[model samples]
Structure formats: structure tokens, C-alpha cells
Target: MLKLLSTTLLLSSFIYANNVSEKVEDFLDDKFMENPRLKSVDVTVSDVVPLKQLAGWNAYIVDVEAYLKAQPKRLIKQRMIWFSDGRIITKELTDMQGGESLTDLVKPPFKDEYYKKENLLFGNPDAKHKVAIFSDPLCPFCKGFVPGALDYMKKDPKKFAVYYYHFPLERLHPASVHLVKAAAAAELQGDKNVIEKLYHVQINPQERDVKKILKAFNKAVGTKLTPKDLNTPAVIKQVNRDLDIANAVMVGGTPTIYLDGKVDNTKKKYLKVQ
Candidate 1:
């Protein structure tokens, strides 16, 4: 009788959680409707990551996809907070002592599976330190930092293993989506220097057409890859996987760095890693 009772409670809890998530999604949809610029909006909540419980509230990191009527071709991805006291939902929470946002305080930790061999951009896999970077090729800050980090890994290959993941800020750099896809395709074709070479490629950031991006990519990377090459199932899958991992890790911007499975806000922690 006790076993059956426990199972029933578990099921009820699961149902309650689902209901809360649905309500959060609806709230976001309604909120977006208030924007006059967005004629119509559809909000899809992809992941509701639970965080440490506050005094009587449950906190969640809500990953949202907002499809706006004004921009049918573009999908906006955003991360928001949801604090619930069972009946009421609030959007923001902060730590009073340190003034840290809940999102920063409870960001998910890196999983071991994230350190895939295919994502390794440089250095020995078994090196003493593992550095993972979520970067956008077109982001000026990434353009400045990534190459220098790669150089450090190259110089001391045994000291650090660097892995690169694509986190294209499509809204800011419309061209980066294609560039990242092209880089993935190049990697599939055994191009070792494609990632480094791509930073130097002079392509218009506002350009969105695939053909033009491919033309520039091929010329600069010295590869004759066509649009079909960049759109192959393998290349598409690789880019998607990288983006998914970036989302999972709550990477909001380019050049988000991780050292030994922890967020490195300064992004230069690897320099001191012995």
C-alpha cells in the first residue's frame, strides 16, 4: 500500500511540474503580444532547468524560442528566469549579499560527455587542462581572443587541450551561421586549420545568402566547397550539435570559456593553468 502511495505522489509531482512549465510558456507568449512590433508571436519553452530552491520558491532557467510575425525568417532564442511560489510566478531573482543574478549563480555545470573528441580544435586530448570555448567567428571579441588561445595551446600542446564550439549570434552577425556551417564542413573534409583561417576571412556580417557566404569561404579557405557541401547532413548535424551544447551550457554570448568543466568568466584562466 505504501509503495503504491509513493508512486502516485511521484506521478502527481511530475504532472504539476509540467503544468507549471506550460503556464510559464503561455505567460511569455502573452508578454510578447504586448509588443506592437510583433504582430503575432509564438513562444516555445524548450528547456526548464531547475535551480537551487529559494526560501519558499522554486527557480528555473527557461530557454525560450520566440517566433515573431514581423520576422518570419528569423527565430529569436532567449534565456529568462521563472521563480514560483507554487501559485505565483515572478521573472527575476537576485542574491542580496553579492548582487549576483540567479542565472549566474545557478548556471548548469559542464557534463563529461561535452568533451567530445570531434570538437577538439587543438592540443593533446589528455592534456593537464581542458579548455572549452563557445565562440562566434564574427564576434570581434572572439576574433581577438580565440586565435591567441589557440596559439597558447599550440605552443604548449601538452599543457592544455582546447575544444571549440559554435555559438553563432545570428541576430548580430547574420553571416556567422553560414560561416560556422562551412567551417564544420571543412572539418569533416579533414581541414585542420579551417577554424583559425575563418577568422581572417573578410565577409560582410550582414550577409545572409548562403551562396555568397560559400563563395567567400571557399576563396579564403582555399577549398572549393559548394553550397551542397556545407549543407550536407554531417555538416548540418555538427553545427546543430554544437549549438545545442552551447544552449545547454547557458552560453549567452561569444567567447564564453570553460576551464576543467567550470565557467571562466575572465576567459583567461587557461593562461595560468599549469
Candidate 2:
């Protein structure tokens, strides 16, 4: 009787795994891979594990491995949900408590020390509401968003704190590296408006004219920053640290904001012009 039970359990597990894998593959082929080249690529989905039931949903974690016919392969870890109403949601999940989202309990997709003192940009250091922004100085969206966030915190100093990190898109904006380093140096110098100055100066990132941009940076922020000031160990280290954090968080573009450690889905809540 024990041997027969073991055989039946193993078969059941195998069938369950196969069915989930097929479903995921079909979902990806139909909805995810939009590019023709990507659709043609081979995909392998495995390691489907049901995590837990929360509220009215069941959480499942899966590892998807994809291989291009003649290119490099990649692996992506995904969190999927199975709703009680026969709906499957991919990407993020959340829980509610007391008629509000329990954002503090939500496990962040990435582990980052964003609230460190060194990363703080503006507002009261002890404010309970923490906002972290990973942004590129040359990104048009960031020019308005980063400074706007700082301004918002300035209004409610007791309620919010802001941490800003540099993520220079060197491929698109070659001069961004220098500007980011300058921002780091300015932060070191206790210049509170480093981000605002950088956005206001409006130097073309593609120009790559370090001296011209440095001159503009100095004029905008009231700092006599030479090229040497940007290359100091502390400045470069801070910039590299920002880059490391951005990469770890998988930030795809500028002005990615996290409100209290979770990605803020509603921009209007935090970013609306006041």
C-alpha cells in the first residue's frame, strides 16, 4: 500500500508541473514576446513552486530560462498569481489591511539599502515616508521629476524624505557620467540643490564636452568645480555605488521612484504638481 501511494504521488506531481509549464509557455508566446525574433527563440520554463495563499490569491514562483537560436541565453525569475476567480496575474502582488495596502509587508523585488544616510538627498533625515529615485540627469523626464520630488518633500519636511541615486545612460548620453560625478561631488560639498542645478543647467549629454558642462554646472550650483573635483575617490565611489544600486534594482530607465520601498504604481499620489 505504501509503495502504491508513493508512485501515485510522484505521477501527480509530474502532471502538475507539466501543466503549469505549458500554461506559462503559452502565455509568454501569446502575450510577452512581441518581437518576431524573440518569439522564434526557444524558451524553457521550470521550477514552478506554489508559495502560499494570501487573501483571495495563490502565489506561485517560477524560473524562466530562454535561449536564442544563435545568441546568448538568459534567465528571469517571476512571481505569478492564481486568483480564486480563475485569473492569473503576472509581475507584482500585494495585500490589504484596514482598508489600505500593507505596503510595508510587501517583499520588494530587489534588496537595496536605499534609506542609508549617505543616499539621502533632501528633506528631514528622520521622516517616516521614504522616497528613492534612480535617475539620469540627461533624461528629459528626470529633469522635471527629480527636482519636482525634492520640491514636494520640501513642502512637507516632517512627512517625507528623499534619496536620490545617479543612473547615467552612457550609451545614449555620453556626458551623463561626468554630470553624475559632479552631482555626487556637489552632494559631498553640502550643496542641497545638486539635482535641481543639474536639471536646470540643460547641458546636452551627447555633446561630451566635459569642460563646458563643468563650467555650466559651476555657474548653476555656485561651485567652482574643476574636472579634478569630479574624479576624487569619494565622488567616483558614490557614483559607482549609485550605478551598482541601480543595476541591482534592474532600473530600466530614469526617474524610477520607490515610495516606502515599493514601486509607486500611482504617479499622481507622489508626483502630482502641487
**Candidate 2 accuracy as lDDT:** 0.67
Off-target runs (Cα >4 Å) in candidate 1 are: 1-26, 29-54, 63-80
Per-residue alpha-carbon lDDT of model 1 for 1-274, expressed as tens digits? 9999999998997787778877877887788788777655665554455555465465656766656676867776666566775678876778787777776666777888999898998889899988899999999999999888888777887888889998888999999999999999999999999998988878999999899988899888999888888788999899989988887878888889999999988887887876
Give the whole-model CA lDDT for all candidates, comma-separated. Answer: 0.82, 0.67
C-alpha RMSD of each candidate structure in angstroms: 4.2, 7.9
Among all candidates shown, the one with the greatest lDDT: 1
Q: Compute each candidate's TM-score over C-alphas.
A: 0.79, 0.61
Task: Give, for candidate 2, the lowest lDDT window spanning 10 residues.
Answer: 77-86
In model 1, the worst 10-residue window by lDDT is 44-53
